[model samples]
Target: MADLSDATLDELREALAAELPAQAAFDGWKPAAVDAAADALGVDRDVARLAFPGGAVDMIDAWFAQVDREMEARLPAEQLSNLKIRDRITRLLETRLDILAPDREALRRALAILAMPQNAPRAVKLGWRSADLMWRMAGDTATDFNHYTKRVTLSLVYSSTIMAFLDDESDDFADTRAFLARRIDNVMQFEKVKAKWRGAGGERPSLTRFIGRLRYPAI
Candidate 1:
């Protein structure tokens, strides 16, 4: 794996992707499967280690990166140009889930792996990455603290929607879409409240209390 110190990150990723499907057919994202996948790629099995130093956790991250790339390709600029920001976000997210539909079982396994306590940091990082991708692809240009805040907020929304999606039985994931809409609506309302507070006087205790009550509330 480390033997090819000159190998580019893309090269390692390609090798992993080539080997991943077969391995994923077995144990989702386990190291044993990752190694087998690496071996199947006709490279040094240890190359899997080099490809993903964090083992299965890293593989999960790569998987999501791949999904994001694919989503961007599938969601063309012209298709998004005329939509409202909220609708753009909805379309992009829905497209992502559509792409993942064929691999639902694999996603379930990946989620379970990520749910382990030891992987919490990786899980958070993955969530951030997905949210960031969605915002960028949705045409976000914010560069200030709003950038981080947007990602964090959307991370929560996306996480909850995905959890709902895992068991979604409604036709075409209608339940998941409904859940996502409610979450988005909640955030939009919160944002409206914050904007009014900022415009009104900056730091009203009542506004703060109201905002506090809105976090993660049941829809």
Candidate 2:
């Protein structure tokens, strides 16, 4: 909580984003939640409202962005470099779940807002952004079809895991952890099969290689 006397709206948004969720858990992402967060952060309520012009979605978006920032802060590149790719991805996702666990009620309400037909596109964008960040943080450098596929697959996995987590009552969320592990295992198996097929020179054409060739014709 720094001095907001000279802070811009975006800075105020970021400063208050982490605090809003706890209030949202009680106020359900309304003006009162913003007011509560503003009071807690010593930010003026009027200025805080200016920071989130898009209303609930804006608040949810800022909070989700804060989660991304926290995720990177918790797991820096050097810390992940020595691990296997699967382990890195698993750790990154698990870390996010842990960061979000305390604000599950707020997250549920946010998801409800994002699920509306009017908000579907924004929801998709947010999901992709998070998935992309996770992949980058896990050290993925693929620029081919793998890039798109990995993010799409991970978005699905992460969303499903969140759904499972919302209702999971097992000890330490073991059920959700098991569900995530199974999804990751399935993805790893798929990658292994794809690699084996490529190595064995199967007749199937490579879409990524074809796209690459289209981009840079034989020189």
Candidate 3:
């Protein structure tokens, strides 16, 4: 709503990102959507087109970036610090679903476009970026192989959850929430087993000790 008459293209892109999805919901992520968003924001149509030279994907990307920023604002560090890692991830994913709830149709259209062969690579990158941001926000500082593994695992979880969310008709998206919780539980259990396998000081654990530890882990 602020005066964007003098704003740079990048600034205009960011400012218009949040507005695009609503227009896209009705207009299907086309040039008309962009033009409507530009008009709504009092931005020049030509300048807005310049801002999204990559077309639909660019508009979708900018909208997702806005969603990420909103997620961070809704769940800042102080809010997540006191929670366990599993809880932090669940909360973050849930927050994103809430943010995208109003624009479900827009999201469906965007996902369809991203699923196309031409956009598959960009889609993967966007998924990874969101996962990485969630991990960073959750206070994860892993720099080893865990860094890559965590993001990959989370990307799968998030993408699957989004698919579930798209068709979820349960009140409050209860089904999607349940699906995400199960996915996170699977990842957490896998991490626990991997940690136990590594053992203290990275020494290999005896089979008996490993089995016993799995059966009765120390509190």
Candidate 4:
């Protein structure tokens, strides 16, 4: 095989340096043997072709474990050093493009609907006040007005959160289960309220059309 160019050799050397030394454990993925088999053999493997000691299965395992580490290291050190940059930019943008008064007013109206006394007729009409409160806490009322326009949005959100919790079967399985239980409780209560509201008033609010038009309102 032709000799690797000086630059290529240097890149391989750096990879070797990274592989040989016990690099810091980043994002819970640690290289098993610091002295890389690839570095020693002078044939470093890129992330795409993560050829590990074992076979294909081993490569898959190693690739998944190293993904987080690789992502963190892929960017230059200077870019990584500016950790607060994103937050600063977001804050600046928020300041520049302030929430329009109309939107705030809309949210305020929704919040008022939620804030009504538990015994208010409008509150009762909406359904169990607890459900509305839960929806508000879910953040559906603020930006999207999803509660008004998407009755099933809260259900979808609950299901999504449950799925996420299930996916995160981390060391603390109990924690995930507990989170799921709380979310399920909220959804159950919300559903009960919905059923009761329909019984009290046979009415189907136009959430579908509202969401559809809201996506691209015809001015």
Candidate 5:
């Protein structure tokens, strides 16, 4: 994961494309899944970046998000085959979130109680800008957009606790919610990072074989 920052964003993105398979060959970007996928790809630390403003990063994000959306709920019977690869990526992301249910039981309880909308499951919304994470990964942003999103939107379980709507639950939701918030905060502060790119969203990749040890230390 530390190696990701050293690689140019472009290089990392390329690697992600190669490994994720676009949820059945669809266009793909799922915000939560993006960085995780990049981490899993294990891109080289020294990959070069072009580092210029006006790069199509936002467009890139949109492209991948679109793919993810199209892939949502895809099934052989639901023959939406013409769906762009990008649109299909949402399902992949959703699938990953499915993987989280067990780790965060509160997440499952929250979804069960909330009766989460079928169109946008609770898990997906928790990390779905589905694209804002790049700047965070690159350590380029200045705003805490990521943190801000957690409290109000579908909160993620960064600290292994409760989150968002789950706060109302009398059982363990509050503790879980608080802990998750703490986790995200701890990670952010440890990394000394912001959610948006303050300088330029696009920067040249570091070419000097640097394995960035995640600016933030896990709590």
Candidate 6:
């Protein structure tokens, strides 16, 4: 195999991603999995070190990115165009989980890793990425405070539903879908309350300021 020293990060991620899942089956997202994948690809395991110095955490991030790209391509844009916004959000989130159904064990392990205290930032990043992608695909073009608020609120909903999904064994993820629906409804209710409050002569200025600073990544 040619040395990957000159390769772009995107190229390296593309190459390693193909073998990572199989390796994770044997080693559960440890550096050993990365090494094993490297061997199978006929590249030195250290190549992964060059590609992602953060080790398993970085690999997990790349895996999520890969799935996000797949979800984008596989979802029919025209079909989503006519749906209501709430329905659009539900479809995008459900489609993502469905795409991941075949990799449940790998996802369980990834979630475990992200649950550790040291991995909190990565967990937040992953949630934000998924939520932001959902909004973008739902045709949201907001560039103001609404943009950040939507992403932050969705991130909370996404993260909680993912935890519930990890142990969901129902046929077709019925239980998980119910849980997700409840959470989405709660967020919608909250948004409605906030809108009413905003219309009530700015009675909740402090609350608005607090929510305004919730950070979201640049689109």
- The residue-by-residue lDDT of candidate 4 on 1-219, one tens digit each, is 323334353344444333332221221112333224354444534531333333322322332223323433343345434544333222221221122111233222333433446525543333332234333323334444335422343333333333344345465445444454444444444446556766788555455543343333232
**How would you order the candidates by TM-score, starting with the best?**
3, 2, 6, 1, 4, 5
Off by over 4 Å in 6: 1-7, 39-44, 205-219
TM-score to true structure, per model:
0.81, 0.89, 0.90, 0.22, 0.21, 0.82
Candidates arranged by lDDT, highest first? 3, 2, 6, 1, 5, 4
In model 1, residue pairs whose N, Cα or C atoms come closer than 3 Å (at least 3 residues apart or on different chains), thus clashing, are none
Clashes of each: 0, 0, 0, 0, 32, 0
- Residue-level lDDT for 79 in candidate 6: 77
List residue ranges in candidate 4 displaced over 4 A.
1-172, 202-219
Q: Model 4: number of clashes?
A: 0
Higher-TM-score candidate among 4 and 6? 6
Q: Tens digits of per-residue lDDT for model 3 on 1-219? A: 699999999999999898999999999989999999999999899889999999999999999999999999999899999999999999999999999999999999999999999999999999999999999999999997678778877887788788889999999999899888877876787678669765655644344443343333332
lDDT values of the candidates? 0.76, 0.87, 0.88, 0.36, 0.36, 0.78
Model 2 C-alpha lDDT per residue in residues 1-219, reported as the tens digit of each score: 578889988899999998999999999989999999999988889988999999999999999999999999999999999999999989988999999999999999999999999999999999999999999998889998678878877887788789889998898888889888977875676567567777997754454553343233321
Q: How far is 187's C-alpha from truth in model 3 (Å)?
A: 0.9
Model 6 Cα RMSD, 1 decimal: 5.6
Best prediction by lDDT = 3
Judged by lDDT relative to the true structure, which candidate is superior, 1 or 5? 1
**Alpha-carbon error at 4 in model 3, in Å?**
0.3
Model 1 gets an lDDT of: 0.76
Q: Write the per-residue lDDT of candidate 5 for residues 42-150, one digit (tens) a residue.
A: 5432231222122223323333443444434333324334544223322232333333333334233323433436524533443345433322222334455444433
**Model 3, which residues run further than 4 Å from truth?**
200-219
The residue-by-residue lDDT of candidate 6 on 122-160, one tens digit each, is: 788888888888999999998976688789888877777
What TM-score does prediction 5 earn? 0.21
Error of 4 at 87 (Å): 40
